[model samples]
Target: MDGQPTADVVDQVKDIPIYRTSVERGHFPILEKPEIADGFPDNWMTPRLAAALAAGEAEFVLSTGTNHARMQIIRPPYFLLNSYYKLWSEHPDISATWEAGCQRVSLTTVLATEHVARVNAKKRGGEPEAVPPLDDRRLDARTLYLNLRLDPALWERDDVVRMLAEIRTAQQAHPRGWYHLDCSGYHLAHLVQKARAWGLWEDFPQPASIIHAYEYTPLNVRRHLREHFTCPVVDLFGSTELGYLYYSDRHGHYRPYLDEMSVELVPVAPGSRIHSLIVSSVRNPYMPLIRYRSGDCARTLDGSPDPEKISRFCGREKELLATPHGPVAQADLDDRIADASPRVFLHQLHVTAGEAVLHHTTFDGEPLDPRACAVLERELRGLTGLRSRIEHREHIPVGKSGKYAWLVQDR
Candidate 1:
């Protein structure tokens, strides 16, 4: 089909009330989350969708809200999981692992683990246990969830021991004693640091393949994982509403996996390099989103609004910091920090009174050298056109959603 909305896309959404005005006008506006949630399932429900729900083909779910407020969405049962498996089984770099029947062990936010446990508990008609059993945390026969804490940096000795044990169990269950690791990059880095410190690294099983799909991983965190694991450490970029869109190969180059979906990039501002991601996807049969603004932003290879040229999934549109130079994305600041010091782990930029202050923590819990701090300050000034200072911190807390906010204004 052509890049524009196809006849099938028009037919799929024409009956929905949210699209009726656009359908009649022959022009679809950028659909935002608020519009999508105003009437929700009722506005989206057509006879076909209604039948799908009744027949158990469609199910209701909430977005993970890592970047913004959680929104309700409908899709085919196990839609996201199926999308992940499709990528894993077909990815050129990791397909061999999938074919070998390597089980997946997920280590991410406690919220995710709790969500799975609660779902399993509901299926069994009981309250969610305080600490879910191994069986309860298993997403399927091939996948298991592990971390039960919000902030990985705050993980105690007991937490690290439990998660490492789970990983070992998952690895041993496979005939080849190999498992695919799925995690947020930060979480895995913290685990490695803690495991080594506690003298438990030897007991931890090395994964056959690693995918950090949960959030926008920092450059330093990626390097830390690479230093530890010999396996492919890939990053999968997409949202809860939309399954895996683009994935990084072993060499850290992103490749699109847009099947039955299309993307359009609109520049965030007049002269900004960052572009907002708008998606037209029919992948979810129950709810086809047309020209939906995904609240995510990216940068292209040549600063053009070409989706195929998207080089980096930079940051959330809502979190972008406006500057005299232009709009600064999380990845923009992260690139400078990573260049100045490889030790920089988690960082947040706070803009106040026309000055920018960067609070950061190092991987080894040591402060940056005076020279490195000077370099970072100069770089920040150049990027933001404001006086800048670097403050080394012992820790930076994660957000309520178990994610880090890179941009903080007046705080």
Candidate 2:
């Protein structure tokens, strides 16, 4: 659209750019000697990108990388605005729920743990046992893990019972559903289980389809909802790079936002065609990324990048747990335990850390017989490589950033 031809713009960035910008965005990571731009970091910003920036189009920046290796990605303002619109303003179901005056009762840990730390029990099962004593737990909202690990009996504790009563009072004051409960599938399951334990299963007002993102919405969670509530349980799929790319239909099956995203598949090994995702989105014009790796495995009916036909968007490749044979994806663990109970959604399995803890939460907060929890613990040990003493924790806070961390490493 500017002075340069499209071909010239495309050719200038024919190769990958070396990234040096701040991991958080805009803070440049490296200042090159300029004598040799060739040796710059990989995934660098190109001249074409600079031109687009000069033209006053790109606005929002998205980050891509592991916890340590983050990269800044800019996009046209319209892309994000539209994305938000489609999610809330345009979606009648969501908008209607919001307009009802629901306040965000986030189960997410925005800050680190705080004053109530000592109360946190030691993790007993899985490899690498860890006990984050109250002093170790962060106080800020960001660090508190959401109560994703639900033990049905947790509600029996006076504090939890009080919280439920408080929530119910707030709901009554608002009348039309006053609170919005946001969490992952696992988190919601814990909530449901907690509610059941209080003899409040039919009593507690259900949230507008508990927004379960940050992980695959295990099928059992959906079944749990359909069986328990009259409300729709939404499952959304996206990454930090792509934002929210796919969401469940009213029926709760994912429908791709193909109009906004372009998807590609890159082989995992050299020859084996089983590939993960590489996204090149026109969503953000400020920083138009070409063939951006999403680190997620996927499969489409036909050999195509068409987002609509993508049959599956499995767990992150990097997050896959190592097993004796090879690697085991999160879905594999989910499948093995799927039959354990639809009531169970939130789960964390740490191997050999403390004892070996398989902290789990179901929709109805009924405590599993210690024996059942033990069975799950043993199964998880065999699945992952770790011997552990099994026990249940009432609390497993989600990261305040609004994503759930499945695997926690202690030490």
Candidate 3:
């Protein structure tokens, strides 16, 4: 989401009085959007599109390049009302995230470290700090850093100081207000490192919750916040078509924001713990779906999921690591990594040569303590049903579709 302006998004909501009556009468579509009555695809943007169209905007589109490839949802007004039902159903607090001077912020680069790109380019105590150029926003609010000349070998000094300055500026602009930090995990991890190097750790602003929604948060980075910060460091799961379906608490555990969603689980294969996440979300009435397969995988941690204790939100179903023994889910491995560090930010588990390589991103700005890494390896080896290699990656690659891939296979 990038620079989404506030229009009368509420007018997009379908009639609620009749739907609420239905819900009270033990019929769910009671409060559902109108498009729901007509039916639409699971991932369609019918309701949201409806709102955008009413405002007369054609740029309404869904996110591409994440796990499910990319899907474009065209929303008209009928579809717009559906979004209200879905967003406010279970998670009423979400309105706050949007209410706090919120707008969508996105980038073309899979791994963007706008926060610390210049600092990583410097030599200790050498030059006057410099900052990279501010993004040029098209009057339409779209931005592109794709051609920003960021040569790794030639990071100058002036921009390093400038980057730090920018981060401070944004955080202070709303010291007590809420803001979404929607950057890559790598970008966040690098920024943390730069903060330590510049002795600016003390100056870092404290937001209500640090949201690592756009990319995966490594276990080590998660621990740092739990060990240090007073506020919550949370993450969420959803696609562009649907705004958000789930969010985690302060301790990195997922809870469903069902809205008007009826979720189902189907096995990826026989006798496999991994199940496909089928969602019938009614957020965009203009695009109501029935039994829609979202192409993501999740397993109930208990016999019946508690909803509140959804320990993990594994990435794309197609990316599950299948082997002779069974399939290894990403969330399971991440839990093990978090067990190793109190503060982690991003992670990549590579299956190579019959062993799992755990590459982590950290807010601590360094590889996990060697002893902790060794201990983590032992736990991961047992979890993955294979040997383990726990290490760090300077930058883990986000999927071609712009989602993080927890598991990768290389012969």
Candidate 3 lDDT by residue in tens digits, 63-120:
4445544455554432322443234233433445545543323222322433223323
lDDT of 3: 0.52
Error of 3 at 374 (Å): 4.4
**Residue pairs in steric clash, candidate 1?**
none
lDDT tens readout by residue for model 2, 1-411: 111213433443344343222222432221222311244222445666566668856543434332223445456644532553356434434666656655433343222122124323223232221433322443222122333223322335454554455456545655665555555554455556666765666666666634555566666766775677666556666654466776666575557664445566665555432456766554554444444566676656674544567666657666666556455556656665676555565666665443446676644446666656666667777767666544455566554443455556562
Query: Each model's C-alpha lDDT?
Result: 0.90, 0.51, 0.52
Best by TM-score: 1
1 or 3: which has the higher lDDT?
1
TM-score of 3: 0.64
Q: Which regions in candidate 3 have their CA more than 4 angstroms from the true location?
A: 1-62, 76-160, 171-186, 305-309, 341-346, 359-377, 387-404
Q: Best-fitting candidate, measured by lDDT?
A: 1
Q: Could you give the C-alpha RMSD of every candidate to the true structure, in order shown?
A: 1.5, 10.9, 10.5
